[model samples]
Target: MSGLEGCWSAPGQVRGKDATSVLRGEWHLGRRYFVLHLRSVAPAQAYEAAITYRAGEKPGGIGSFWMDTFGGLYEPSLGLGAVSPDGFYLDYHFPDAAYHNRFERRGKGWRWTIVERAPGKPDKLFARYELAPASCRGTTFTF
Candidate 1:
């Protein structure tokens, strides 16, 4: 029943070969639903988004809003993710782009591959990371 509520960080990030992102969140578990506010951090960039999930057998979907280096803001983006017993997939869609990604947990972290499909040719990307230490102390909340 672990959704997006906890203060989680991806300790490892690949360099130019991949995009690395870290996330922290404040989650509220309701009688039958859950909501989370998450922030992503990287070398020189940061963005925030909100996610909502309901109590169910499966991990629910997601929604996100973020800013880019181009001084552009993207909102109303819809997405979904699920972690299987041995693997995981995260899919995101924006106005002009769509991304499908799959990952498998490695020894201490996860290895990820993503396909960015746009109006033209689709591109494949790869990355690997070994979980690093996270300082999310006193940053987790549930209501």
Candidate 2:
């Protein structure tokens, strides 16, 4: 998981609106879990999240615990994922919808995308970010 341990900055779209985000990945629990902290810097919506990923039952599989500003305090947002060629993919199910999120390397940077699927509606893009290595200095968002 060394590839994921770093600071990153992304400029992309969230729900079709322009947005920017800062992300930092760090190992926690004595390396038992990799926690990713994200903060949105644009759109004035103040979105933030911390996603923790751990080894799954199957080899090379991953399980995630997602907590975000939009999630209910009592709700549990879990996901199952598998390691892919470039990065990985996670599928999360919510009460009203499901989301497929992918993080993959593209050239020198990375691309993170989320697609939403709901009953009676077509799959739609929820967020897409092009991430690049960034300095961790002076960032307000912390673990």
Candidate 3:
């Protein structure tokens, strides 16, 4: 997860609206888990989340827990995924909704995509972010 151990920033779209995001990642808990902190920089109602990823039950798999400003009240907060050559993919499932999230290397940076699926609804794009290396200074969130 060292590839993700730095600061990243991106101007992207979230929930079909313009948004800017800053992300910081580090290893914690004796290097047992990789924690990522994400903060929305633009838009008055900023979205924030803390996600922790660790080795999953299966080899080369990842298990994650997510806590966000939404408080998990409206979505599933747990994810199961597998590591790919470039990055990883996680699937979040709940009674009412399911999401497929992808993070992959793109050139020297990364791209994160989120797609949402709901019952009786067509799949929809939730967010797409292309992140590049950024300075940690002045980042709003403290790790």
Q: Which model scores highest in TM-score?
A: 2
List candidate 1 segments past 4 Å from native.
1-6, 11-21, 25-27, 31-43, 51-74, 81-83, 111-114, 126-133, 138-143
Taken over the whole model, the C-alpha lDDT of each candidate is 0.48, 0.88, 0.87
| Root mean square deviation (Cα) for candidate 3 | 1.7
lDDT of 3 by residue, 1-143 (tens): 77889999977898998888899999998999999899988668678888889999999999998788887574438899999999998988877788898999998789999999998999999999998999998886743
The better candidate by lDDT, 1 or 2, is 2
Q: For residues 17-73, what per-residue lDDT tens digits would candidate 1 score against the true structure?
A: 434455443445443444444343554545444544433345443333333333345
Candidate 3 overall lDDT versus native? 0.87
Judging by TM-score, tell me the better candidate of 1 and 3: 3
lDDT at 18, model 3: 85
In model 2, the clashing pairs are none
TM-scores of all models? 0.52, 0.92, 0.91
Better of 1 and 3 by lDDT: 3
Error of 1 at 50 (Å): 3.7
Residue 28 displacement in candidate 2 (angstroms): 0.7
